[model samples]
Target: FEYAHETPKRNKRKNYLTITTGAPTKRSYLCVQSILYFLLLLNSVIAIIMWATNWYQLIIYKVQVLSNNSLNVELWKNPTWQPLLSIYIFNYTNVDRILEYSEKPNVKEIGPYVFREKANKVNVTFYQNGTVSYQVRRNYTFLPEKTRGSLNDIIYTPNVVLLSAAQMIKEKPWFVRKTLGALISATKVSAFNNFTVNDFIMGPEDWFSKIGLNLKRALGEDVPSKFGLLTKRMGLSGNFTMNTGKYNTDLVGQFEYIDGRPGLGKWEDEECDK
Candidate 1:
């Protein structure tokens, strides 16, 4: 009876095939896990790249200058856009009537003589404390096309030097006034002078200025050599000390000192000086 029960042999090949089929499901699950991990790694790399790009943009925004080492220094040294000066002169229309008939002076306003001005920083000295000291030199060039009147046009203007001198010495001693009158008579200086617009604004040293300047010097008065509308301001500006915007961006071009003084002492109040 035992020999009959053991007669049926098990199918070993069928069992092996079933085991191999089950192994394929496990392999598929592992492949899916690997795919998920690769997707996660790709997403993380993209996020990191975006963050770095944002950081680089922030750096650029913080330093909005031409050079990384210097903070808006080049632009401060030389401005791209130059300012323009427009001058208007009063033309004496009825000088003869006013002088001969004692009539009120008739004046007519003329022009818009335009000039382009260029200011350059000179004698620049940079300090280690993020400050810069320099002087500004201003140059003006006449813009013929922009001017309303021709420079060669004759203009009748009052003798500014003579009038100013008369007013200054009016309160002085009689001897001083008599001396100035004699000087004016000797020079044959008139009450008004006829000059070209160009000469009046920027001169070849008019006769009145020369004689007036000499008289002023004889009186021991300090005065400028030339007298014109814009001639006095054509030179270098006073010494200026300013922040270079290195430490604080808001302090660029702010004044620290004018000439050698921290503030102008001409005012009565100390706060007004600043």
Candidate 2:
């Protein structure tokens, strides 16, 4: 009777032990499942955020194109023409700057004009006389260094605009002289109905000096001739003046206040010395 009673107690203890162990196992499984669900939720949230942002950008880009004029094929193939077209299209479309050129030589002919958030606005015009002009307007208060090169490259790509004024004079001396004379004559005829070599050439010394200066500046060394100096000086002076602002009258008084200060010369360095 005592042994049978002990057997029932032993059986009861075994059942309790099993139930305690199983309780902990079920709790661990629940915890693991909860953590897995949280991780999946987090991943889904991140993916949704990325998709929303990208989709918004795409929609904005599409909406910005107001006209189909931007899809012209001739403008895409010609680098010289594309810059001007980009300026007009962007201005009319009221879109942010995003045009980019392709790098691959083969595709370079095709172009990869993409919009970037931070590009300068270029004013482009096509004249009735078959000339395409590009004017770059810097958005920043301070001027950027690369702006000049960018403008020149856009206008002067291969077979685009003709050579620089100095290059044209050198390569076609008679033609340049005749053209300059004709332009002066036409202007005079329209105004006072008279023209002369004096009006067109400035002076023989001035012409030679201007040409020599331009050549020297363009080639970056003296070419050992009167004409070379003229070209270099002319080109250098023209480029310098075009890039810089005119001196302020208020600054002139301040400059005169200094002892032994030089007056502003025709060029930029001279003005700095004052």
Top candidate (TM-score): 1
For each candidate, the alpha-carbon lDDT, in order, equals 0.81, 0.33
Report the C-alpha displacement of residue 249, candidate 2, in angstroms: 49
| Poorest 10 consecutive residues by lDDT, candidate 1 | 14-23
* lDDT accuracy of residue 161 in candidate 2: 10
Using lDDT as the measure, the top candidate is: 1
Which residue pairs come into collision in candidate 1? Answer: none
Model 1 spans > 4 angstroms off:
1-69, 170-175, 214-223, 245-250
Against the true structure, candidate 1 has what lDDT? 0.81
* lDDT digits (tens) for residues 103-150 of candidate 2: 322212211122112222233433333223232322112122322222
lDDT of 2: 0.33
Question: Cα RMSD (Å) per model?
Answer: 13.7, 25.3
* Error of model 2, residue 22, in angstroms: 21
Model 2 TM: 0.17
For 33-69, candidate 1 gives per-residue lDDT tens digits of 9999999999999999898998876575455422235
Name the TM-score of candidate 1.
0.69
